[model samples]
Target: MGIYKILKTAILSLFFIVTVFSCKPKKAQNENLLLSKKNQLKKAFRYPNYLNKNYILGKFDYMNSNNFVIVPKDLSNKKIYIRKEVLVAFLKMQTAAKEDGISFKIISGTRSFAHQKRIWDYKWNSKYKDLPPLERVQKILLFSAMPTTSRHHWGTDIDLNNLTNSYFTKGKGLNEYNWLLKNASKFGFYQPYASKKEGRTGYEEEKWHWSYKPLSQLYLKYYNEHISIEDITGFDGSKYSKNLQIINKYVHGINSELK
Candidate 1:
């Protein structure tokens, strides 16, 4: 009887030891995975600095009415388009502007990927080639992108007011721009890039660009950390060879005269 009790106690002790040993490695691995996820989140939320080369201008693309907000008056024959969510925010902006006695209009929004390619080719082949590479890059960055790399493609960004009259210049008193800076956020809008700091951003300051804050903020967070220029420009054209050729021919070659 004594021997049986002693043997039972020994077996129970061995079982407890085996269970603990089996669990330790799994617990350690789980802790490591959680730590890795935490780090990724931290990186995503950091404030963006202009100096970051990743701060390339986002590409724009033309989307159908379903993706855009159409202002009835602005739709005059032309299909007026802006990001669906942005259009809603713009409506809010318009209401706020009305209260403040300021008028706001969307001068431009959403360019098709093909259209962007054309603008890029025109700028690159035209007078841009005469300038230094860095300068050329800067110039192009102002109004265009290197084919397929524009945020406007997402249909969530827009330029307010006419480019000619409401050009984004530094230190220009914000009489009009200021109204947006103060009120846009209330409508869930924000300027992703501003002109005050040139040393950091290779592109020119564009006060006119406003993003629907909720989406823009999320995009900014993801883009700042994970996206790369290669992802924007590298598309398999063969899948849509004809469309690609069209983009290459008409859109890219449209401004050949300037080149």
Candidate 2:
């Protein structure tokens, strides 16, 4: 026990296991770009806005690891999850859009009022029971999200890489939507269905969604100060959740500097 005190207790137990995982959060940057502790526990996790109806059809689809996380790296093999600060600004904007080639890939993220009530009861009783619950809620708001005003039940949204918009346009989905419109707001991300060419309303024009606008602007200002529409009912077209204006046209639709 004395060869220089057993090599100084094995170099202080390998410097206490590399200073406890060098205080964690890899996608690295203490390469001294700093920021770790699992990206500061992914900037301190906090997802909520289940907007009650027994926390949206029973504990927001098994409470995705209790307020979501998952995305260690599986751009879409499956699990995905989201808000650990939107997977650390989407893996730092998918590793700075793969050094110019752009490859960001999450197919969709977060959704649970019992997974948007089985996608609003498979488009309301199998593809719009023959339209007219206010034009099948305007053709399921031209794409979806009626289950408790979904911003994917607020895990700071994301649907990226290509869910259509003709996969962005042309080459590498028009260079991944022009490298997410010139570097996704320096990494906080936006694009909540922007172009109606210019007008914007309810939905329609979701060029592969995105939104981590610094924690989906506090869950869209706490679903506009504590959600209503009778806390957005249970399922099956949810009686068009109180003749839907859906909190000023789909919960402040978006893009206007993310409300």
Candidate 3:
């Protein structure tokens, strides 16, 4: 072959090889970028109530995520889970209460669906078992919640120093109660179930139950919008949820200040 033609052929082959290799990496890089975005979208959809029902229904495990923190021993009678933001506010409130010479403990915090179910089942098989189903449920509802319907599931409500209403009626309990009534709201907390004499429905007066409104209020909004009586199954007497207007008279029944 002529020298010029031979050199021309070599140059053409070199250009072809360089072009093919360069095109391959560009194609591969494009594919990798697309895959990365898809994975990111999946992760984004996983958070902030993915199913909208899971978190509110107590299906998610806050213990397994950074979204919750353990309640400190001094603040609670037992190790309990609470939302991180709620804990921060409570600590501030605790300090303020201490300065006023009043003190309290957290008797209960987050309760998962399974944990609540155990409570419900125990009561279901208690002496009330002999009573009619509706009556039995009503009796339980006086102070207890029906599993998924509980605000405790949200990690934003805590049962305070005492459980009995009489405890907060006078003496030290009364002092503590008065303090909370006067100052708890400054920390984004509020009593959920107030005295029936005030015309509030749902559970009986529980002076100890305080909710972190900033977060629980949002969760409550989600629960009302996403949850229905049909979703409140897996327990005895669940069929009566609709008849009892559990969503309205119960879930929606809160201190008007909370609304």
Candidate 4:
């Protein structure tokens, strides 16, 4: 072919490549996968008023109900929320468990910073106020996140079926927990407080709490690299945060597999 024809063919080939590439789904970008540690931190911190969802502390994830979907009343029984994708995964898990004569419920799901504070303060005022500030803090952290730091803020962590180990020891709770242990991961769920063969610290072993790993991993990374004890506040005994070294001992002090 002549030079013009050759150049024309080359241009057409380039155009075709560009068009096809553009038409293809934009992976990573459109999928919202946070694969890079650095980029993950940047994106986590960049959300506007992100702190507002869980208070100004680095404990809560940003909320856009559009990113969340209301769960069916049968699954949750009470009004509850979770990340939209997480809701989908839970539905699938629920369906699978139903096949095995196991059913599940969301004992607790998404919680905003305000909701967490209410839980924290209620405990502080009613149950543990007589204890030393440090002891009180520890008592709460045994099962609760300080106001701004609860994983529930992410809408990916869930409290399921029952919160007690005894409940999971026998009967339907046993079946449910077993079903989850065997199957939740298939739907992207994980227990965040199971004890190791030897021992572990931080929160007591909560047999009920499960996190959606894909997004919670990113959130945990944000907490590890960005949040500090000093950054937590708006609750009783938070001033003891630094004294307690909550940043490492509590916030990061979770099931190692979770991290």
Error of 3 at 118 (Å): 0.8
Off by over 4 Å in 3: 1-51
What is each predicted model's overall lDDT from 0 to 1? 0.57, 0.74, 0.89, 0.78
Every candidate's CA RMSD: 11.5, 17.6, 11.9, 10.8
**TM, every model:** 0.59, 0.30, 0.80, 0.75
Cα lDDT tens digits for candidate 3, 1-259: 6999999999999999999999999999999999999999977853364436878999888789788899988888888999899899999999999999988788899999999988898888985889888899999999889988999999999998888999999999999999999999999999999878878989988999999998888788778778988889898878889999998999988998777
lDDT by residue for model 4 (1-259), tens = 6999999999999999998888665764655554576688866765334424333343444444567777888888688888888888888999988899988889788888788899999889988989987888888888888876778877888888877889998988888888888998898998887864546656788889999998788777766666666568777788987877776766666766678
TM-score of 4: 0.75
Q: Which is the leading candidate under lDDT?
A: 3
lDDT of 2 at 30: 60
Report the poorest 10 consecutive residues by lDDT, candidate 1. Answer: 250-259
Candidate achieving higher lDDT, 3 or 4: 3
**Residue 118's lDDT in candidate 2:** 85
Task: Order the numbered candidates by lDDT, best leading.
Answer: 3, 4, 2, 1
After TM-score superposition, the amount by which residue 7's alpha carbon in candidate 1 deviates from its true location, in angstroms, is 29
Give lDDT tens digits, candidate 2, residues 1-259: 5799999999999999998787774435564355456677867875554444444323455444565777655587567677687887788888888888678778778776677778777887778889877777678778788777778776678787667798688987888898888889899888888787777677888878988887777667766766777776766656665666776877786779888
Q: How close is candidate 3 to the true structure, as a TM-score?
A: 0.80
Instruction: Name the candidate, 1 or 4, with the larger TM-score value.
Output: 4
Clashes of each: 17, 1, 0, 1
